[model samples]
Target: MGMGMGLGLGSNMQQNNSKEWVKDASDAQKGVNEILSFEEYVALAEKRPCLECRPSCKYIKDIFEYFGKSPRGDYNLFIKESANSTAVYGQQRVYEHIYQNILNFTEEGFNNKFILLVGPNGSAKTSIVRKLMEGAEEYSKCDNGALYSFSWIFPIESYIKGTLGFERRGEQKESCSSQTYAYLEDREISSILSSELRDHPLLLIPASKRQQMIDTWLKAFPSELETVRKSYLYYGDISKRNRMIYDALLQSYQGNLAEVLKHIRVERFAISKRYSVGAVTIEPQLHVDLRIQQITMDRRLATLPPSLQSLNLFSVQGENAMANRGILEFSDLLKRPLDAFKYLIMTMESRTINLQGILTELDIFFIGSSNEIHLSAFKQHPDYYSFRGRINFIKVPYLLNAEEEVKIYNDQIASLKSKMNFEPHALECLCLWAVMTRLRPALAKNYKDKKLGELVTTLNPLEKALLYSNEFLPARLDSEEKKLLKVSIQDVIREFENENLYEGKFGISPREIKQIIYEISSKGLMVTFVDILDFLNKFIDRKNEHDFLNIAPQGDYANPVRFIELLKDYQLEIFDHELRDSLNLVDDRSYEGYLIRYVQNITSLIKGEKIKSQITGRYEDIDHFFVKEFENNIKLKESPEIFRSHMMTTLGAYSLDHPNKKIVYTEVFTDLVKTLKESFREEQKKVIVNIAKNLVFYLSEVEDPEHKRSSSLSEEGRKEIEIVLEKLQGKYRYSQAGALTLARYLIKEKY
Candidate 1:
């Protein structure tokens, strides 16, 4: 504590997760709540923007931040601001492509140049953009020891919610998220003395060769090495501190710390590299003695063509790039011109905008994003077509090949462990959540594109596991208490098989299940496994049914044909009401009471502790799903009206918005009531009873599938619902509308 004065950063600068470079991302993100001014934060981020290579101009970001408003001086370019790290963060490999994707839109004669990135909520699209800006200030240094500065001297500005669709035609949509008008705001100050070198030029740089530029630029300034010393060993702030921490952390490590920092040149401030990129290492330069020279760079850039010549960067003032480039404006193309910067769907879509003199002919790059209208996202705006043929498509397909997925998994896990210094198994947990999230869209609320980095940084593995646990099992285990109950059911199997709790039959009462789960959890370790069915039969009183030693049944518990039938009979007697509610029991019982009773019976039978564990395997699943389907099973047999009511009612029951009270009998279930009345009248008592019994049996078996959707839903939540419907229709109902409606329900339930 008294060491604050030793570091000059003040004792307050003591290493925390955010300041820890060697720690995993989970650790780094723990201290992310610190309040920092936007400017300060961006500056900090710029230093460590991309781990790939040193950035161009360290001040390039400032130019965009302060004066990125002129649209080629003709139109406005709206540069988006991302709040989360993910918006701007990605694998170092993708960083260059992210830029290229946007830059490609600026190609010659391209129309609808703006980008419209579209995705479900929580997707990392915005995070990618954010990191881009954060690290945009500087790029890798040049082959020379000079720093490679990058900035869009073209003063561009955006109204976080402004619009510049079409001025003369008055054809523009309301800025969905924000209205950004990037234009070149002219200023006379110049960091570069030559007129041609005053403003910054946007150019392409390939990934492979970019590493060389980074080596050189970093060698020029020891300060930059502080941040990345750990990874790059040259310039990085956190890395500098990381070395000190590393000394403390790895003080006993096999590698010597003294040897590591021996050549770091902590004392000598400025150093120059002998050659940059492929060049040799240079010696250190003292302060003021080494001059800062303005020189032309003839570096080889892969993303760019041979035509480009000297590029300039302005330090003090924003330039007129906006004035010349004008605004990169776009109107709804509805269908054609799909490749235009179409990824900017977060804002400016269906709503109209009056772009009069505000926009002339706007030209800019557009990263095509799917602008397909989402009725759920925006209540089906009549003006916006459901099928917009606008924008080009860059296929980032679902990883179908198992080998491809393995590669992706390896990359994600490796990044989390190495870059973040996450604890052992950190990668495993991240991969688990990512795969689970992707495989169980219902659990992930239909969120596509698994971003392991985001999930790790946001929540721990235990929680993620818990969230996705429901994905493996079909039953909706929403509460921690209920999840524990599910676990108790597993424990019951232990008692049923090993102990003589019931009259020898698995008579599992809701109360006993609840008691065992609660009591066992207190003892440490939870009961879980397919062996749970054995416990359910404990209370059945299987006196003369069958021999226990014969044990070769396909299910967890089986007996001779007659004995098994008797156990089933007891199962029906005990779980009569619960079975009906979960199975779309065609009866007069209110869906609300039936659902509650069913949930209660099972929850009661299993200890709340086990229920909790089952709801979330690794951690608590606040937004993760334990059960995301099954309700749709009723829709497979029920009429449209009944299906809607059932889905809506279920949503109301579990929605965070409606978590305070029960919503079973609410108007949402009126259709359910109507359906029940009609069906019961048409069908005989035995048929109705059969449906009820079937519903109960299927509901009991519903569990989250352990895998995910590949070409199949075997590990999917849909099977639970299908299991219930099978009794009614004997097969899955493949109607497109039915699938759509059920899919909607699945999404709502999980998220």
Candidate 2:
């Protein structure tokens, strides 16, 4: 689906702003840790009141139990849903409008009942909504993202300020133990307090909490201290001036308790959480809630809102008025009618839903959309007053303008040309035609009437090309104009077939539309002032294949059984340049030259494999030898002229003027006699003199007979053979082998 295509929209959906809120937290567990002195350790522990409780409640569990929204009953965090995302439409202040409207449900200042986005499709209406919620984070100036903590940020500071109150210290530990809260036996307590009580009698009791201590602890402490007060910490009255220390310690302990409670409450400040971005997420539970109230859906229209004659269900008299609801989706909005607008309007008005015995007044936000339908419903009945100012229309416009169309087509052509060559105008005309006619229906399909919390562009940029190539051009059009063009072009193509598509005149075919357009555009026929009438008819039928070789025998004609005896004497040809030479009788090419192309058009139907396949089957092995043989013989021994000409055509090089050809001849011309002798063509010498001059050179290099092989004799061997060949052929003599004429003439047998 190419990223954003399959899900009814393009895959490269823009990332939303609040994404940070849900992103995984950093690995703090693997970071640094710290240790502190006894007193410092106590103080540091006091700072994090969050450690006191859990996710639901940071400190005071009782408070969390009363208001938290978790199954655990301890976490006060609300994991519910709400439409609190804030979207900004490229600074158009659109998201602010949606936020303002949703807020109006609870915030009385701007009590707007319905908020709408009225604009052309693709004008960023939905983008604005998404931007509000999941928008560009760089601008938010918040690096970490929206952080929500249910625990106090600074608990220690809050406690010290008296914002959290506590008074009086408790009994202290008396045992000579290492732990803070050791046993408080009479014997140990007496030893521990002896120093403080004697030095500072006043420290034994604080004026404020002194009376309660006397009644609650003093009487029973002496006898029961071992069992009941086995563990305790003494913070007050430890010395001659310990009285002051005792009072201070008691006050500090009381303060710590109060701070812990406040820390728990402050961390859970959902009581006042607000959106820093436009997107507010509701959990699955909320979506489920909305679905529960919706009626069963049917195929044609997802069923209608359950009230037309029973219309009172939405007014003030109705229990669930249209004043409170969560949402109004514009699902398949374009498929509905323009006049069937009343239900959509009701959804937009503030509404409520009655579910299970609970009269839930939800702030229903609405989305309504439809392509041109139901316009008459508004006029057909005088009583049809369903539509008000609720629907916000976003019109999807036509495909590209002429200029954009050109840009699109050019982009596609440039992309394709690098991999597979095509004449520039050839691709252009095809795309231009489609843009002008075929893409109309696709552009028209997305039009719908309704607004959303956010909107997105789901269309792909390449769909036009794919659809036209595979579906529309071949199957859809049956128009008179198209039919006429096919008939006219068919006649021309038939004439060419009768004469085997003449040498000078261009062949006509459906593929010619693009080429002809290119020719017209490039001034090939100088038709600058002429208009093409019925162009489709003037070209060939795109449907048919050339039929001349349709009836040929299918096999290697060398095998008598495979050959039609009547055709044995006829000559044939080969086309694949890799298998033949390039001096095609006709100079049809890119000014570079022409191809010998396939001669005799050796068409075949092979259910089994042959030598080419065999050679191809072990191509790697054969290739190793082929390359060695070509370099040693074909590249070295052949007269520079033969090598240059043969190699040039093999690579699709048409003109002998190629610089590589020049380099080959420059390096290999050994004798003027041999070079000049090879140049004498049929026109220069009808008798074909020194045809032996070329033959001896070609045959001298041939080591394999089944395949004319180029095998360069090695240094030691060359000197040895050079003596024999030279004596037999004479100096500055011996012709090249595998006649370009005969070789080109015979390769037709194989293909």
Candidate 3:
């Protein structure tokens, strides 16, 4: 009976699979080989409202939708899809500059300048350009980003002789019902001429008439007409080869525009980096990137009609030609000799490249990247001023924000995480150290306000990193000072921006950190923050190899050794919190609840009224003793009345700023919470120390089989230690070995 049931199931599965295969095949067939005529292309454009004519600059800008402003008020492009991907981070300033340039270019009717991304080595200059190319390729496949190019289709002599009145006068006449040869089979066509430049299909229309027809079609969508007028459709001319073919066809048809358009096959094309279609990256080389070849005598063109054959047609074939309608990136542009790319000055200004004697008009967004060293050297050259006018230099600095730096490491090492165990905060330690190395010390003289300058001048590297990450303000700052520092964050970031030696221009890049991480993981041990610190220390010892490390120390800025000490101190604080939290003696949220209740009682006491008790659901006299006890625990220095007044003022301001929103007291009173957490840690020090000791003992026993289990640990203590280890492994992503290492470190150093 079991075998018969199994057979029935197998037969049912086979039938379902057959139906799925058939459906998939049908879907595949529908998606393959889609070719549209000029008329069909125009119809598709009309149906898709977003498929309007646009220049490369505007088109590239439209590919990335604005996701909204970030917490730092920088515009987000939503380029980074996941934590496991290495996309742009904390470089919103760079993107803003690029967007502004694109907007200016589009408004000016076309892109006529090269955008040079100037930065230090390993600053994601190449990655930024690659991401744009990737976005372009992906956008091309979407209906809204549909791109069209035309090919010259010459029907077989037998077919064309019967249709275009090109036949002998005495020959028999044949009727052709189809208006277009776009869908003709290979057997019916003698030759198909496709432009390597991927010229727009609209370029086939006479330049004078193209805009009038486009304006008529876009009249119903008035908003689209303005964009069309600014695009290549209105201003751009066809490539030299395309122009030749177009003129030849027009003359053969005797000004019969419809007959001329019938032979033009408008097909949808996608940008492909692999094929170098619309996105081409030119590496530093001595050879020219634009060239043309005569194709009139090729065997494939032997079947061309006498009209086209009579012309000396040449095919443009090169990176510049291929990237005509899209983006063209010159990677490490300055690395090449000056003469190699000197033609760009004219090309950028005129929006045209001269291949031999043929002038090919291009509709491309030109982008290039170079390190600051190369750019600086180039600036010393006599021709620098001439090239500078045609190039818009945008800086792509290294990320100074530690939290954003952590995201980059996480992305670069995501695949390695599955193969090895990583202790929590390991990457954080690395990122913090790297970012601190990039920071320039705040100069009191640089600020106009002396008090604000003094306050910022006192911040250590760790405090500055915390401030930049928005993690926390320096504990030393008063409320007003904290607010000042918060508001002046952008100013502090730009302190050294105008200087030749910028903060981010010299630092241990993400690439270097990645190498150290892989080296640490190569040992086949649980990766811990300790290992990261040790590796960084060794790296600093070999500072001669890195120019940045050899620089003179400035306060806490260029001192790599001091940054390590700061990172270790920060790591210990993190360990203290983790160890205390693992005890699970009190829920962390309960502390916030306690603060809320205390605040309510104090408010009612100050008002001399009864307060609503959340626990009992009844009105009662204010709990004065409870309020005093809470204030004492947090070590409030002010008088009771003054403290109450300040609390009320803070809450009133917050309520005004955030109406109808539930107030998170912790965020509103960060300094108070810090004091409360410090007091709580002090009260739980004994319990935390006991748990850490017990965990160390347990880990030692597990590591050494012969080591006798500690009889000093009571039954409850053993269970608590087990729970702590479990929490460390589960909640904090610590391997057993990693938890043991941290436990030992905390016991010896922190506890």
The TM-score leader among the candidates is: 3
Model 2, position 449, has a per-residue lDDT of 19
Once superposed on the true structure, which residue ranges of model 1 sit more than 4 Å away at CA? 1-108, 111-113, 134-136, 139-359, 366-382, 385-389, 393-423, 440-751
Q: Considering lDDT, where higher is better, how would the candidates rank from best to worst? A: 3, 1, 2
Query: How do the candidates rank by TM-score, highest first?
Result: 3, 2, 1
Give the worst 10-residue stretch by lDDT in candidate 2: 594-603
1-751 per-residue lDDT for model 3 (tens digits): 9999999999999999999999998875443335777776767665663465666777877876534456776544434463333567778788888888887886766787889999999998888887778778777877667787888888887876555433223444343323677766778888888877888877776767878877777778775577668766886788787788778888998977777777778777788888898999999876778887787788876788888887788877778888888889999999999988899998877777777777778888899999998998999999999998999998888888888888777655777866676678888888888888878888899888888888888888888888787656876665567667888887787788888888788888878878888888887657788888888888898776787798899877789889988888889878767766777754657777777887888788878889986789899988778887898887766577767777888899999999999998877886787678888878888877777777766766676677555455566877888888898878877877787788788788877
- List, residue by residue over 426-518, the lDDT tens digit for candidate 2: 333333332322121122222231211011112121222233222211112222222332333323212222232121111122223335555
Query: Which tens-of-lDDT digit does each residue in 243-310 have in candidate 1?
Result: 23234323443465322221111110011112111111111121111112223342322211122122
Winner by TM-score between candidate 3 and candidate 2: 3
lDDT of 2 at 6: 57
lDDT of candidates 1 onward, in order: 0.29, 0.27, 0.78
| Native RMSD of candidate 2 (Å) | 30.2
Q: Comparing candidate 1 with candidate 3, which one achieves the higher lDDT?
A: 3
Q: Estimate TM-scores for all models.
A: 0.21, 0.24, 0.88
Best by lDDT: 3
